[model samples]
Target: MTKVDILAFGVHPDDVELGCSGTIIASVQQGKKVAIVDLTQGELGTRGTVETRYKEAADAARIMGVDWRENLKMEDGFFQINEANIRKVITAIRKYQPEIILCNALEDRHPDHGRSSQLVEEAAFMSGLRKIETSLDGVAQDAWRPKYVFHYIQDRYLKPDFVFDISAHMQQKIAAVQAYTTQFYTTQTADDEPQTYISTPDFLETVKARALMLGKRIGVRYAEGYLTKKMVGVTDFNSFVQETT
Candidate 1:
């Protein structure tokens, strides 16, 4: 079985890259094994087809240096929080047995983002329940739950419980997002396709601006914000001190 230190989930292919790729890059640089699980192929997206998005997601995963990437093949706009879907997510959680799980924002501009967040959160909890049996490839699996569950900020600005300093990985993060040529503004993309909200140049600029704003809060050049259901504890005050220039 493949084990990872962190498992990140997103409702769409580019969601993880747009929201938390910087953090993922930084974590991998720190020798932590990370994986990505996209809930859908983004078939309902206005721009790219499912095949294009899958290819883009694979390229983004490569840029982020993730151990693996998987798609649940769920309905893009209408997947429900039912028993079947919950079991699917639970099986993945048990399979990877990650130390931490990062998921979509609890509240976001996209309805799927919020719904998927809740679904992942609930499944993470249920994954630890021994009575709720789950198996992988006909082999019985053991119950496993991550030590921490964090929601990455996306689209809407919510007060973050904590922020990760990803200053060094910001450029790589942008590169990962840019991997989705059909989704974001890029010089290579032709004008034939109808432009959407995210296809505009200003959208990318706004992403940078948000990162700058969050970085300012944590005294860093760039950072990614996250929300946690439970209050996180620190081992010491020294870790919180800002570095001297």
Candidate 2:
């Protein structure tokens, strides 16, 4: 079993990069083991092919310093939250055995993001049931559940339960996002290439501004916000991130 401290789930290859690469980079720098799971290959994306997404995802994973990444090959924009899909998610959760799970926002601009979020959330809970049998490579796997499931705010702006400071790794996060040159605007972008919502330079600028805005709320230079249904508890105030007054 490849145990990890955190497992991040994204519906598309670049979803993780756009949403929480800064946090992922911060965690890696803190010596925490992290892995990324993309629920789909992003074949339906207008700007890139499945093969291109695979390459971009690998590049981003390397930039974030995640231990490893795997794509579930779920149908892009059409995967259902049923027994098969849930089992696949459960198997991954069991295999990684992470204490924390980071997933897409509960609601986002892309329907796939919200759908995948619900699927992952449900799977995380069901993974704890001993009777819910799951296996990988024909071997029976043990039921495993994460301590927390936090949704990274992506396209839609909702109130966050907490914000993670990633000031030190903000540049790294941008690099990760730029890895998908075909999906996002870059210096090398062709004039003939079709521009979509995320493929524009302005969108990238907004990404940076969003991080800065979130950081401002916490008196930091850069940060990522997250939402969670469960209450967060702390043993002491000493563990909290003190804001600079």
Candidate 3:
């Protein structure tokens, strides 16, 4: 079985890239194994076809240097948070047994983001229950829960519990986001598709502006913000203290 240090979950193909690609790139650079699991193919998106989105997602994964990426093929707009969906997520959680799990924002402009966040949060908790049986490829799987679950900030601004400095990875993060050519703006694109909120140049600028605002909070050039339901503990206090000299 392939094990990873971090497992990121998104409701749509580009959600992870939009929210936390910088963080993903930074983690990968630090020699951490990371994988991304998209809950849906983003078939309902106005900008691209399911096939196109899949290709874009794969390209983005490569740009971010993730170890692996998979799609659960869940219903785009109507996937329910039931036992069936929970079990599916649990199976992946056990299969990889990641130490940290990153998920969609708890609330966002997109309804799927919030719903998927709740689903993943509940599933992560239930994954630790030994009585909940799950198997993969005819082999009984063991229950495994991540040590930490973090929600990445997406469209709407929410106070972050913590932020990660990703200044060095900002360029790579932009590359990953640009990989979704059909969904984002590019001078090369022919005017064949209707312009959506995300396909405009302003959208990309807004993304950068948000990153700048978050980075300013920590005196960095760029960063990604995250929220946690539980209190996070650190082994060293001096590690967070800014140097005056």
Candidate 4:
């Protein structure tokens, strides 16, 4: 079993890139082991095929330096919060045994984000119960629970409970986002491809702007934001020392 320091969950292939690639990049740079779990192949996306999503996700994962990444193959845009789906998420949680779990926002412009957020949150709790059994490869699995589950602030601009400083990794984060050439704006995309909300140059600017705004709050050049149901406590006040952006 490969234990990780953090397991990041996204409902679609590029959700993690758009949402928290900076945080992941920073964490990996700091030597924290991380893995990404995408809930779906993004089969419903208009611009790219499932095969393209897999390749782009792999490229983004490489850019972020994750230990590994996998998709659970949940139905994109339509996965329900049922026992089957929850169990699927729970199995991944238990398999990785991460100390921290990052997931989609509680609410977002895309409805799937909220739904997947709730599903992962619930599964995180259920995964700790000894009676709720799950196994991998034919062997029985032990019950495991993360110390905390944090939701990354995506699409909708909700106030973050805490913002992570990712000043050093902003450009790398953009590179990770740029890996999804078909989904986001890039000259490499074919002319016949239809333009979607994310495929615009302005959309990329908003991604940069959002990080800038969040970074400004924490006195950093760029950052990523997260919301959590649990209260985050700090041991030392010195940790809050402001740094110039």
The TM-score obtained by model 4 is: 0.98
* Structure candidate 2, residue pairs in collision: none
Residue by residue across 82-149, what tens digits does model 3's lDDT show? 99999999999998899999999999989999999999999999999999999999999998989999
TM-score winner, 3 or 4: 4
- Residue-wise C-alpha lDDT for candidate 4, range 1-245, written one tens digit per residue: 78999999999999999899998998998899999999999999989899999999999999999978999999998899999999999999999999999999999999999999999999999999999998999878899999999999988999999999888899999899999988988778766888898898999999999999998887888889999999998999988938764
lDDT, candidate 2, 49-165, per-residue tens: 899899999999999999789999999989999999999999999999999999999998899989999999999999999999988899899999899999999988888999999
Q: What is the TM-score of each candidate against the true structure?
A: 0.98, 0.98, 0.97, 0.98
On a 0 to 100 scale, what is the lDDT of residue 7 in model 1? 97
lDDT of 3 at 64: 96
For model 2, what is the error of residue 154's alpha carbon versus the real structure, in angstroms, after optimal superposition? 0.6
Model 3: residues >4 Å from true position, as ranges?
241-245
lDDT of each: 0.93, 0.93, 0.92, 0.93
Which ranges of candidate 2 are over 4 A from the true structure? Answer: none
- 151: Cα error in model 1, Å: 0.4
